[model samples]
Target chain A: MAEGTTDVPIAGYSAPRPRAHGSALHRMARRRSTTALLMCVPLFALLAGFVVYPFFYSIYLSTLNRDMTRFIGLFNYQYLLSSNTFHLVIFQSCLFAITAVFLKALIGFILAHVMHNITGPDQKLWRGVLLLPWVIPPALSTLGWWWMIEGSYSAVNWLLQQVGIHPIAFLSSTAWARFWIIMVNVWFGTPFFMIMYLATLKSVPDQLYEAAAIDGATGWQKIRFISFPMLKNIISITTLFSLIVTFANFDIVQILTAGAPANTTHVFATYAFQVGINSGNIPMGSAVSLFMFPILAVFAIFILRGVTRRTREAI
Target chain B: MSSATLAAGAAAPRRGRRPSIARERRWALWTSYIALAIFAVGFLIPPYFELVTSLKTSQEIGAGTDPWFTQHLFFGNYTSIIHNPQFQIFFLNSVKLTIVVVCVTMVISVLAAYALARMRFFGSQMFATGVFLTYLVPESLLFIPLFKELANLHLINNTWALAFVWPTLSVPFCTWILIGYFGSIPKELDEAAMIDGASHLQMLWKIFIPVAMPGIIAATIFAFTVCWGDFLYPLAFLFTSKQMVLTAGIVSTLIHGDVLDWGHIMAANILASAPPILIYAFLMDYYIAGLTAGATKG
Candidate 1:
């Protein structure tokens, strides 16, 4: 503590009395804290205006009638609960988020291992290629994907046509719509997982692997004993992060599928936009988007715990 | 002692496998290369197609031909999109909004992060945790409410609304990042600066900012990209074609009703997405560290 400054006065400098010193120090500390609080005003205002205020406002908005004239309590929620489209939204959101996140993690794990295995400069070359997909904005990249799968200009279907197979419409069928949505998401997200895993994988000590090698453990055995254990923290953390983002994904679904093929592919975001913005049913849209809240809150709790623990350890 | 147990547990079954480990390792390396090649092709195929489609004339794209090969390398799509004054506005708006938002986000985040990390104020711990939780709130979840709020303010169809709301998306994460970065500097440096009569702002500007340059750059890049790439807010709030930024503008203008312009759209998409991609390619380490550090600390 930088306390008792007045008690240790410098040469030829008169020290203040003990009581005066205490009061001065208290005033200084108070002033410092006041300045600190003032410094955070912009952040506090933004959070309150954008996040906190809107959070409660959405809760309020979700309860109103579609036109916002009449106060209807839980009507929108009840409507969504009863509606088949909302049911499909829930089912498809869960399926897409879980399946895509799982594939990303699995592929990321494998690629990270391979990247770690490469001893030469080729690692950089492969990494540059792999991470390219994530570098492009999701909206722009989804447009590229949409171009490839659109009618008549579909490169994939062209190749399939050559194989004596029928050229299928990729995004018009319900099953195919869900499949492609999850595919683009997994494609966009896997590089993030790979980069995260590869970073943590690099931190695992070489001696541990070499020691395991000398102990008669095979490549798979070394991974099971060493790499997996070391990577457990990051795997959970990155999976949780990716899970939240994937659950709330919009661009791919909006640009590529637009919740199409009979409203069979609606995630919360797209459905919210469909009802609220496109259809002009703001209350119902608010209700749709608010369905994403409970899961987000659940993830937030775990993310806070992990991130704070890491933050504390870093400090 | 632990190694002894581990070695004892594995030595019996692994004794004969040791001699073949070298051969097995070679095979694994070859398999890994093959796997990487597959992944590389899979990942590159989309962007490759984007490039291929952008280079060809409309007839080639309309012919339902193979998109893998670009026979005539034409630059008309790029030239047309660039020459169009409407696209020029969207591009300029994106650059302007992104620059302004990045500056604002950095100032707000760096100040708040420094304050929270350094000076103990009322509910600072709770405030710090609140920052992290705020970041987890996806923009998708709040777009509806924010839309209504912006409308009530009569800011709909106005680009100014985005200027006000865009930093909300970036500041929380950037603050969290700067807090993590600022937490690393030794306390004695600050203590010494304080003893020498440096104000909080001076210390932040003169000492901490210079020391934490990498973190600042990383956070700036993050803010810039988020603002540049934000599709939902602009899509909802900006109804006018002139009001939309690059991401939304490209869709609104390039796709007129049932007929979509593939060449110009891809070119615009390429142009719209180039900044962040180029930034990532150049600053991969800091970008990755800043991005993943939110969950998995660097």
Candidate 2:
């Protein structure tokens, strides 16, 4: 009401720039390039400060020895390559990421299908309730889980005894230590995948299923042909994105076990924090963290390709 | 068969739906409800126990007591945490830091997204692509060097330093999400606004922002949740008990030494996680819309 659209012609209507503001230029009515560039200054500046600069700085830091006085130049990287603990760190990180992501993806896919099958007002209610795990901060939730699963006083163990089963020491044992770590990760992460897959399911046209029904196609055949193909791209994309995140996850292991039972459960982030921050070995820590970069870069490239392709397909 | 064969399976359901098809769907819906009910019980376990633990007294939280049920309710846990000055400081610090980070992120992302999506300029396309690519940069890889840089500036071990570093986590994704929102707006709005002599800032303020409010809310929620829940930055940057925010503070301070206070810790956990939970509950559609928007559009 205040702007009065047609009555008060906006200020520059009389200014003569018609030729410059040709139909081609007026497509979104191009602003002067300078204005647009000026607007993006803060964005570029931050990326430089936070990502680009620190990335190079990490590479530089990784080259030095434990002391800052001398540059060892790839010695730290070579040292990590042969180190026994570092070998386990790399293996554990990959193992943790792949297993957690695979479980989360499978569970999320099933739950998403379940969510799609429900058609009523209660769908939103169920979705809101089911998504609670991803909603809580993992650090806090991990604390809750740790309290449940951890020690002599563990309620989970107490429950096990009530059922006449032996209480398993989740953290102290080697295999179970890894199991719980990945389990916590899947618990924290699965809702994200479910929600993403649910969105994918929603986007598929419903009529195709009806048509399939008319043709006497079984539900399994419909899924094998239609849903799987539609879900394939998003599944790959969400899985790739989750892979990068789970690979670098720090909070769960750090708080829960602190990579205990002799550092058997450490992923890259926790191990880096241990080597770099806790131990005060910056160079070694940098090298440990840097190992994740190439793998992350590969996953990221695939996701970007997927996202761009999806955008193109949507258009 | 339809002339277009399988490709035309998406052809509209003709007349009344087939009875078997309706029966199959109804059966699927019932099965899905049962499946989701089971999953919901599984999903709610940890939080339920956490809440149950919080409601029990400190003495009642051990192995002997039933973990699943709280027979005698105790509000003392909440009162104790509320009375603790240290927790008060941590909660207040989180609020302050998250507000500033969310505001700064929104400003940078909204402006940057508007420019990139609408105002074509030198390297704008690259910057737009850069926004998406930056989402791939894990905070773990950058934290070590960022810690060094913050220490060099004497910003380490300070709560406010997080205000600066936290935006790095949120800005890229928020900007990308906003770009999708702005990109989807019809170009005609822009051309009309431009011919009316409105400037870029004016158009963004008066035209684009109103239409994209949902996107802005989603991005804001994303930024707030990221900042509110972040562990590493505060844990690395602020080590002192007094300087820490909620998540790192609770983990580092509340759990000090060999003795565990299960009731107090669970109480604190519930309190610390309340903001994100509340936001998710209220603005769920916006939150999920943001997620889908980023995935499908951005």
Query: Which residue pairs does candidate 1 place in steric collision?
Result: none
lDDT of 1 by residue, A79-125 (tens): 99999999999999999999999999999999999988887678877
Candidate 2 docking category?
medium
Give lDDT tens digits, candidate 2, residues A65-111: 89867899999999989998888888889899999999999999999
Q: Which stretches of candidate 2 lie over 4 Å from their true place?
A: A1-31, B1-19, B257-259
Q: Which is the leading candidate under DockQ?
A: 1
The residue ranges of model 1 lying beyond 4 angstroms of the native Cα positions read A1-16, A312-315, B1-17, B20-27, B257-259, B296-298
RMSD of 1: 3.3
Tens-digit lDDT string for candidate 2 (B1-298):
3323543456546323534556777888889888999989988999999999999887776547778898889989899988889899999999999999999999999999988887666667777888888887888998988989888989998888997789899999999999999989886687688677788799999999999999999999999999999998888778888898999999999899366777888888999999898998889999999988888896
